[model samples]
Target: MPREISLCDIKGLVGSELGVSAWFTVDQSMVDSFADATNDHQFIHVDPERAAAETSYGGTIAHGFLTLSLLSAMNFDCLPRVREQQMGINYGFEKVRFMTPVKTGSRVRGRFTMAEARFRGPSMVMTTYAVTVEIENERKPALTARWMTLIQFDPKDRPSET
Candidate 1:
């Protein structure tokens, strides 16, 4: 379940951990589907047999983008939702580093920290999260990124100036 946060309080929570998502398995079928959707049928991602022989991973691995794209669902699973916001948009990532390959059948989840939050306008707030995607039983994380999101709300909902 997503936690609820008042838009007025977001800035106060900077540098705090928002939440951690539940584990999600990245299996071959999902990888294959992602490959089909994105046309990234590289052997390391789609061909288990060949990948086992050719790569150090021992089997097919998920594409870096596929793993990165899981952030949307993970966000919904663990991040807080702004109580007064009508919608939120992906503003994109400032930085992304794929440190470890996510092998097929690996379970991964996201850990989010509120790195920064500032009001862009009366109706919009720009938030940056320091994110880490951890693979189960792995010493190193699959990836780390600085993600940005734009939250839009009614201007009338803004708190009165003191």
Candidate 2:
């Protein structure tokens, strides 16, 4: 089930584990599609045989950015939602480190920790999540990032300051 909470209460969650998302498969087809979409046809990402012979990774690997992009879908499953919110949008990333290659056919999931949360305005909340994209059963994670999001709350739900 989805985690539900009031936007006003989110600030209290800083420094706590938010949640972990469900595992997602990173198949070669998806890798090829991402390559087509982004035009990042690097051999390691789109060419299997050549990648196997050329790189240490052994076979085609998912692009680093592809793993990064999956964070959004993972967030949908595990991130908390405001009771009266319009929507949340990507604010930016503080940092991102690709520590391991996610080979094609690997499964990945994101573990999220609430890094920080604060009121941006009367009805806007800004939150940062320390996220790790883990490759299934791998000692090293695919990537780690500090991602920020802007949540727009309904004006009626805004808390009044004392």
Which candidate has the highest lDDT of all?
1
lDDT of 2 by residue, 16-126 (tens): 898999999999999999999999999999889999999998999999999999999999988777788898889999999999999999999999999988787677888
Error of 2 at 29 (Å): 0.3
Model 2 / residue 83 / CA error / Å: 1.1
* Each candidate: RMSD: 1.5, 1.5
lDDT (Cα, 0-100) at 47 in candidate 1: 89
Off by over 4 Å in 1: none
Across residues 38-124, which tens digit of lDDT does each residue of candidate 1 receive?
Answer: 998998998899999998989999999999999999999999889998989999999999999999999999999999988876888
